[model samples]
Target: MTQTASMSQNGARGLVRGGALDVLRFVAALFIVLYHVAERAPVSLFALHPALSRGYLGTDFFLMLSGYVLARTYGERVLSGGVGTGEFLKRRMLRIWPAHLVMLVVFVAFVLGTAAIGLAPQNPQWFQWSQLLPQVFLVQAWFVPGISGWNMPTWTLSALIVCYAGFPAAWRLTAKVRSPWTTLAVGVAIFLAVDYAALAATGIPGHQLPLRFGLVRGIPLFVLGMLVARMPTTIPSRLADGLAIAAGLGVFALQALGRFDHASLALLSLLIYAAGASGAKGSAWASLAGRLSFSLFLTNQLVAVVWFGAQRAAAARFGFDATMLWLTWALALPACVAGAWLFERLVDTPLQAWIKRWSRREAAVPAPASEPIAA
Candidate 1:
């Protein structure tokens, strides 16, 4: 095959670009936000009442996508000595932490400001200093359990950091496996075992493993995504595109039914595979939205709280009915979108550029002059 053909088939690599996966990222992030709307709403909307009830699964999709994209973008470089582990980690940290820290500070200020004004947060437990350590260090999901303390959605970032730390080793090990399919199968089995174990132990998956065991919840699927990345993307484009459609439908159907956890994951895997294999270039808007998705996901809790706070302050007279819930959701959704866009442009974009420039300067800096006496 020609080089261009190969590149198209394999999909673009790196965080800034991918093969239609950015669109998937946008969709997945939106799904989670809508899910949160249903959960936090005084009453759920008729339109969102069905599939969104299980929308927390969107985070599961994000975890897998992260693994897949990282492996595709950096795995070969790390394995081939093109990128050092230190640099790889530095880049990952630069990608996430600057934006994350900004949001963390904002979240903290919101809590403190509200408390000072005699308006204790509705979820005061998350505002405690106990969560500060984990949140600051991005280890909440690993060290702490149940909730992500300051920002509820950020636990995923904590778990992702863990995965990023381990990915070099994991990628190298999986590369040696004779059959990537077998590795994926084993991963799926392990995931099922853990899921069932959680189900049996708790009698319900309700806020059990996913909320508390971020490491356990994340690692297997992450490994599965890496394994998937190893497969040749030369599958016929038409077939892959068709499979993508089918997988999307399957995801919606399973979500609506709200049963069979593994099936949902399987469909997600198929979606990723199809997206990678179909040779579709992501649209500009999709790419921009995907880039903003991190901001969107991380800042949502704060925005929602701010919306509710405003409502309370205004004495808007909310009620336990669809109208009030929809109204709050409507206001909150736009705030999240605008906040995400602004955070991406003002905070994340500039900070990332500065970090990259700093890294380059550090690399360019001359080591201390060798001591003449030693020479």
Candidate 2:
């Protein structure tokens, strides 16, 4: 008999349990929470010192993974012509907006409630209508003044909008790949061109990258992911394994020595991607992270506001020395997990479900045979 099929899409990329991707996402989210907690805690907690902080790395992982997952989830649809501009925007809105709106409302309420109880420090100046409207409209991302949003936690939503705004063109361009490498080359060229063009113009590519791309910075990373999906076996295992070891060791050594900056950090990021792309199996932990990653990214900040507040209050009540910081991080783990669960069920889950329901179709359209997703 032919070899048994061990791997499968298993249909629909909806939250499948026992996945390594989800687990990784959860861990990334957990790190963000811990990072925030440590930052806010007393320095007496030497173990929770800033030196131990690699929390922001979580965002890097997220940006890289976003491209990868979107390729897996939506690449087929784009190729098949199932996802059109209208349907594309609709589905994306379904995926992100409902939960987003709910979160915004919750954030506002929490702030107001905390203030009501006199638990939160008053910054009445931060509560201006001028800044509030842009955030509610999700346009605050374009408005620096609105960056101080009461619900300023919606940066991803804004970044995503920037990404997908160009999705139709990206799909059309890659839709004509003669081979995997051809498509990969095209995507890589775009990223490098954009990367260097900004540099050539500003004299420093990486430094100018943020100002040049701003919200669209995630697009190149996202395209990196799409290219990975298009060229599933671009990097051989042995070479990738070596690269992974080098990258991991480099990151650890740098972090250990506190010498890693943006340049080294970028290289370290590339290494992480190479390693992750090499024969990545869906481990249980990764699955957990992938499942909760979206929630974690979006929910962590919301939950942290209250959790951190309570920690601050408690530390104030008792005499918490710097040593208490690490303990605060320890306490944050359970609180975040529990909060993520509740936030998911009460807010993220239902909102996500409702959005999905609104956009559900009886069949998924495939692209024309002349322009297959992997033609």
Candidate 3:
């Protein structure tokens, strides 16, 4: 079958939902949680498994995946004017904003509660009140100082919002290039140029760009995702399967070797493309995990904050042994995962339903008739 026929036969199944990518998303979220947990734990998981140290790469994967998924879902509609820019952004904002606001409030309460009880955080600078406004407004990642304050992971969300704002233009640009190969080449070139420029300007790779300028790090990868989404899936399923396996192994190998080359990022992109092209309908468990991935990403930091804080307080008061600390550290991972599941069901799901209902009600209400103009 032709690429178009394959996609149609599958009902664009991989792009729409239920695919290996969902499982990958959950795994990425898990690694992100592991990354943060390792940061705060007395015994670092990174020490035992060096590859765990590279978990920040999960954010890069997420940004790229967001581009691919959004393009697949809305690119055509957006380009053809079936979805207005305002409406698209509004929906995207609504999807993320409620959970973010709730998490922000939770962080604020945690900070205030700890302060009231005279329990100071180990890193007080991370909870600066001065940075709260920018975070609240979701512009913390846009050249703002202290962008890493409050909920540090939310920096990705801030960067993602900026990407979403520019998505229509990015999609149009991607589509305007008639040849998929040319589009792919240009996207790769732009990403490499930016990556190297970042390396030259700041000793950090573009993917590791500072949180304060996360938009710079996010846009190129996101556009790369859009470009990948627009490419024809002409490779056979068996070849796509081989590509997926190879790319997945390459990513792990690079991480294990402590190599932070652009190849890992390229491998991640390839892994996503292969998974999509293979057209495997994902299992229900994978779908559920995928649904919880956003919550997992957003809430893990908060979980770390609370878990570590309480561990510190308890240890100081009781003079707990290393064994107790280590045990609690192990438990932190599950706590983070469970916290994410609860937050999604109790807070995000309900708020999203309410927002949809409110939107429908607003749409149903007819506009008031214009008053007659004075002569």
Candidate 4:
């Protein structure tokens, strides 16, 4: 199949891929996977590492990255009328929803099959119609309570769909801001205000809230990301490296201190900008990881469910101690990476190409003629 055209219809093709951003995406995805498997690690080690516990903030990292890339790419196309908002939405939906729906179905089927064999699926919400309907429609993050229903990680996808739907208007509004710093400050303030309000109400860090609250969790960072993309400030490589290191340290400190709130979001924005500013220095490995990261993020939880279930079964059969859990930890990461790579090759890539082919065919069809009134 032909490559996806440039995000802007008029711009040159192939701006979407490569750079340090790819490396960052891969790392963020890996962090999230390890976060999910943290329970398998030794209690003392897990307790000591705040970064691993709060690693779910990796999703927030993804949201910021998404906002930056989408704004830099599609934002321009929509604003310039090079691509209609409807077309933009269609393309974005094509990029995300097919794979999401496929996995959603797979999860449901897996649950049912396990139930048939007399094993109760771990998450009961998967079978509830009330919860399943919203998730199937990709609005679970807006209304669901825990938001970890079905494939839990998809809360990000649901929130992202909302963001994509609003991108045209958001981009228009963002363009009106004359000063990039003001835009950046406003975005940061909105995030902090929301964080403060959540803290005051619940006495918990906002990022610790249910995944269903991902709508709130995602928006400010997303806005900040877009503003970062729009920023005129360009730090030299030496300074960018320093800032990146500092920001990385800041992220660790925030997580370590259990301040998993807007500070985490702010630090993530800085890290992404430091890595992505100017342009990405592309490499084969980084590009491969970037290509697989989405599939990895989307599929890992399902694989973990199966893997952990097997580990439990093994523990039951063999009477092993905590070592089995640690064994699962040793194996799970590579399994996830391999599984995600296969999913990308077998499912994600071909499904995307098929949709693109169908889209082209639909676009080629002539519109029906309007009827004239009889004289």
123-221 in candidate 1: lDDT tens per residue?
777787877878888887784754557787877887878788888887778778888787777777777777677678766552236554777777777
The lDDT leader among the candidates is 3
Candidate 4 C-alpha lDDT tens digits along 1-375: 111223333332233255667778999999898888787564634676656666757877888888887876666666777776676778888888899899889888988899899998655655665578787878888857643567778888888887888888888887898887888888877877887777788785455557777787777667778878776434565776677788989988877677555667778888887765523346678678898899998899889888878877887898877776677667989999998999999999999889889988987776667853211
Of candidate 3, the 10-residue stretch with the lowest lDDT total is: 1-10
Which portions of model 1 show Cα errors greater than 4 Å?
A: 1-19, 45-50, 145-147, 201-210, 315-325, 367-375
Per-model RMSD to reference: 4.4, 6.7, 4.1, 4.3
- Candidate 2: minimum summed lDDT over ten consecutive residues — where? 1-10
Which lDDT tens digits does candidate 3 get at residues 1-375? 001212432245335354677788998988888887886667677778777777768999999988887877787678788777777888899889888999999989988988898888888888888899988988888889763688888888899898888888878877787887898899889998998899999988888898888888988988888888876666777888899999999998888787766788889999988887775655678777888898998888888888887888899999979899888888998999899999989998898889989989987777657853211
| Number of the top TM-score candidate | 3
Sort by TM-score, top down from the best = 3, 1, 4, 2
List ranges where model 4 is wrong by over 4 Å: 1-16, 42-46, 123-129, 145-147, 233-235, 253-261, 278-280, 321-324, 371-375
- List model 2 lDDT by residue over 209-263, tens digit each: 3321345445665666556555443456567667767765776677667745454
- Residue pairs with backbone atoms closer than 3 Å in model 1 (clashes): none
Candidate 4 residue-wise lDDT at 375: 14
